[model samples]
Target chain A: MTAYTATVTVRLKRGVLDPEAETTQQALERLGFELSDLRSADRFEVDLDAADADEAADRADEMAERLLANPTIHDYEVAVAER
Target chain B: MTAYTATVTVRLKRGVLDPEAETTQQALERLGFELSDLRSADRFEVDLDAADADEAADRADEMAERLLANPTIHDYEVAVAER
Candidate 1:
């Protein structure tokens, strides 16, 4: 089996409130940096063994769907690479 | 000036503890998924006006350094793209 690293990025769906991003934007403004808006996401990198890249991606997708991401509020994408 | 979006990613420095990632990994294992290790990071996307991409990136870098990231335990990157 080949080893792979799967990267999953999870972001809040459009219209979802992102308080942390908002707070961060405000802090930037206070620091004299100008910005219109801000959004934040969570990125997960998982290392595992699999027969091929596709298998590794499938497993990582399952992980994101089941635990790493909250479906109702999150949108996630997965990318796999040999490790 | 033009509008730009800057992406900043914050990750725990090497040797720092990441309990949340550990918990997520355990939960995945409980669900019958195998993985060697898991790491997580936060990504921020900021939109702002600047004279050019360089200015936007600099402002975003400042944001990451001043508040978006904790230098002691976090490492961040800034990327800028026209919006």
Candidate 2:
């Protein structure tokens, strides 16, 4: 088995209300930083033993689908790299 | 000015207690997914008009330093892409 790190990024779907991002944008503006828009996401990195990159990605994808992301409101992407 | 998106990823510093990640790992184990370890992070995507990629990255880095991440406990990275 090879060690692989699966990176899963979960973000709210488009048109969803992102109060956190809004608050962040306001905070940046308050600090005199100019920005038109902002969005926020959660990223999870899982280190595990797998046969190959594809196997690692598959397991990570399942984890995202089952726990990391809310299917109705979140869109997630999974990437794997050898460790 | 050109449209750009700045992606800032914030993660806890090593040795910091990451309860969320620990809980997530436990949950995945309960779901029958095998993983040795897991780490969680926050990512922010800021869309704005900037003079260049470097300028966008600079602003995003400042945002991360001032608001998005806690310098005492978190580490962050900033990436910029044309939008």
Compute the lDDT of residue A31 as modeled in candidate 1.
82
Root-mean-square deviation of each candidate, in angstroms? 1.2, 0.7
In order, candidate lDDTs are 0.91, 0.94
| Over 4 Å off, model 2 | none
User: Model 2 over residues B1-83: C-alpha lDDT tens digits?
Assistant: 99999999999999999999999999999999999999999999999899999998988998898899999999999999999
Among incorrect, acceptable, medium and high, the docking class of model 1 is: high
Task: Pick out the ten consecutive residues of candidate 2 chain A with the lowest summed lDDT.
Answer: A19-28
Best by TM-score: 2
Clash pairs for candidate 2: none
Q: Quantify how close model 2 is to the true structure by its C-alpha RMSD in Å.
A: 0.7
Report the TM-score of candidate 1, chain B only.
Answer: 0.95
Candidate 2 structure quality by residue, lDDT tens digits, A1-83: 99999999999999999998898899899999999999999999999999999999999999999999999999999999999
Top-scoring candidate (DockQ): 2
Name model 1 segments beyond 4 Å from true.
none
lDDT for residue B74 in candidate 2, whole number 0-100: 99
Give, for candidate 1 chain A, the lowest lDDT window spanning 10 residues.
Answer: A25-34
